[model samples]
Target: MSAHYVGQIAPNYVHSTMQANSDDDSFTFTVGKLDAGMAILIGDKASLIEFPSLLLPSGVSSGSVVNIRVMRNDQQERRQKDEFDQLQEDILHTFGQQPPKAPALRLRNVTQTSVTLEWDRLSLATATLLSLDIYRNGERLAPIPNPLHNTSTKLSGLDLNAEYTFHLVLKTTAGTLTSPLIKTRTHTISDTSGISVCFGHVAEPELLEASKQALTNMKAKWSDRIQIDTTHYVCTDPRNPGAQEGSQGAGYAKAMQLSIPAVLPHWIFACHDQKKMVGISPFYLDQDPPNASSIKRSVEEVLGKQAPASSATEADTSGSPPPPVEKEPSSATTTQDAPLKSTPFAADDVPPSNKESVGVEEVSSSAPPPPIITTSAPSEDGDAEPQSTPAPPQVVITSSESSDRIAAAAEGESTTEDAVEQTQTTEGAEEDADGEMDEVSLGGPNGDDEQEEERRSY
Candidate 1:
């Protein structure tokens, strides 16, 4: 059967009927004769009915056509609800599958021994995150507990000379999420002795430059002078305790002593004079006393068993000395002192007729001795008293220099002690002076006394 068309339904609803006495003003309808699944409509809109009946108001027009169609209300409602659920599920899945993003990690205020690492927090809402694991190189270090969400963590006990790679991994309920790796090289911490030498002294730019050069030379020539562990030498100059101008050297020594426990176990002060180079053994309260035997053994191991006073004094100042040979103490000197006698190595034990015989030449033989005069200053008691003043700085012959002459003197077959005596005689002569004998009287016989006097006058 062909369906009849009807005009569009109006949104306005009217429930009242016309005021005619006759029944033609109202219309009545029924679905009683329609098929079980046929749709019925009052106007354009239709609703499906299954052997159902509906009534329409009475109207006078008998030719009016109402449209009828099927509508699946239950099926449409179910489809819409399903689509909404799928959309919510997709959002959650994306969040779970996506990788955890790590903000740029930074290491701030890094020093030789320590550094601070920081990063942005992960924002995964579903998972509960626990501690963060720290890594160096490829090894996993101890995890940082309860890491601050927005702050940094300080990592200590690091080797300054070594390179380190650091990164963070977060432990989550679902799994672990690793951040991007950050690579950085640690600053080298110089050996402890280097720091001790520089302690308390103001390291100006020039002084620092000099110190760096000196350190390089020291490392190259005397590697054993520096300790590897428990030592940290930074560029920064931290304040020294109880430091004063006159006591600066002492303060530096104290600082060095304090640092020894933490940085150096075996240490000695190498003191050099015109005659020899001697090792002043380090004294530690907790350790065994450093006796001459131990000192001699250490020196032999570090330097060599050349004559302690002779070879060192005759050595060339410009070049490094040869490796020292170990030797046993002489029987005559065995009972000298507890510290000195206990040494297994002695000066005589060293071979006198070695490859290059060091000369014991007098280093100051070319210089002439000056006359010494005492001047008295009036005292508070109106009596004349000798006023003491420091003699001018002199050129002290180093052991290295003595070693150079030792070989030459041996070649000439001259007595090394005779040359050494000559040098001492000249040095003594140069020390004497009259009144305040300016720079001229202090110079050696071969020195430019006239030029020195002119410079002093200016």
Candidate 2:
């Protein structure tokens, strides 16, 4: 009967437990973990009466023993259920639990040390509401003012190029509800001393980090949000000025617009290599940065140097002009190889069989690539300051195994320096770590011309 009574009155509730103590009709016991149990026990028909003589705490009078108690006829939770629910809701709202929706924060501006956050004020959350908690990475942050009616706040003292998580929370007797996590990262600058950079949302994270480190070393600043002083914008695509004004991206684009030159990664590297602020004129990369050499020329232009002109007769900027051309390692095919320019050789100087061979003629077959250049002596201190010692002319080739000079033409001859019929003492004879002679060899295409053979060290 009691179970059936409970079924109709409180289907999803537990029975409350109570102890009948004879001490002044008082009892002490705990309620079970069920929401409607106590409420069900407080039914309208609940009553108290004297217990049977056989039961615990039995007595003649109702006050002498504890029993199921009934509410006084004048007592009631409230005049109406709606009033009770309204009262509960009012208490929850009074404690900042107006039933808030999640806060969706949008990134405003980010700097190396701080970030600005913008969000809408939620309907249930009001100016007089209880504390609106701000949290970063689950750790609560203070100081945003209670009843946080403001729609935006700025977070400071952050790491550059680092990730951060944030959310909003409202706590009250009703329960705890929190906004979804909003994750973001700060920006790193490119050239601290030169441009104040503002990286856009579309920028690469790794590139931003690298640019920050590079820029810091360069003494530049990178910011997450655009500031009035930002000089440049680093991104793959920057919008035009005055486009979408007041929008999240428009302000940043305005900072990037004209007067400020949009630079490329090429310019970054070029500036680094040149150790100065390079121009964006040709360094703009619609694609991958141009090859390093091209960037080098661009860098030089910014450095105020006139690009060198090409000459039909190519000259080696390095001092001693390159020796005459020699046949490619392979002779079966003709190649467009041009050798060093030289004066016409005398008819008597050429072998009789090949009389037409003069000036810079390619060496015939059997010629190996010219020997590596080993040493170059500075010219006499004449009128000319050896304009940047051009690469030293090819030196003589000698065999490490013995003192014999090895060239395609110097097949058999006493090793000697150029202009000397007799050998000069091979001074400073030394051995290398491998126990081999520290021999130096300088060979060119004029394989047989001993005149071209200078000093030989082995």
Q: Worst lDDT window (10 residues) for model 1?
A: 269-278
**Native-referenced Cα lDDT, model 2:** 0.45
lDDT of 2 by residue, 132-201 (tens): 7788988999635645467777777788678999887766434566777788776654422535676654
Q: What are the models' TM-scores?
A: 0.27, 0.28
Report lDDT (CA) for all predictions: 0.40, 0.45
Clashes of 1: 36
Highest TM-score against the true fold, candidate: 2
Indicate which candidate wins on lDDT: 2
Model 1 lDDT, full chain set: 0.40
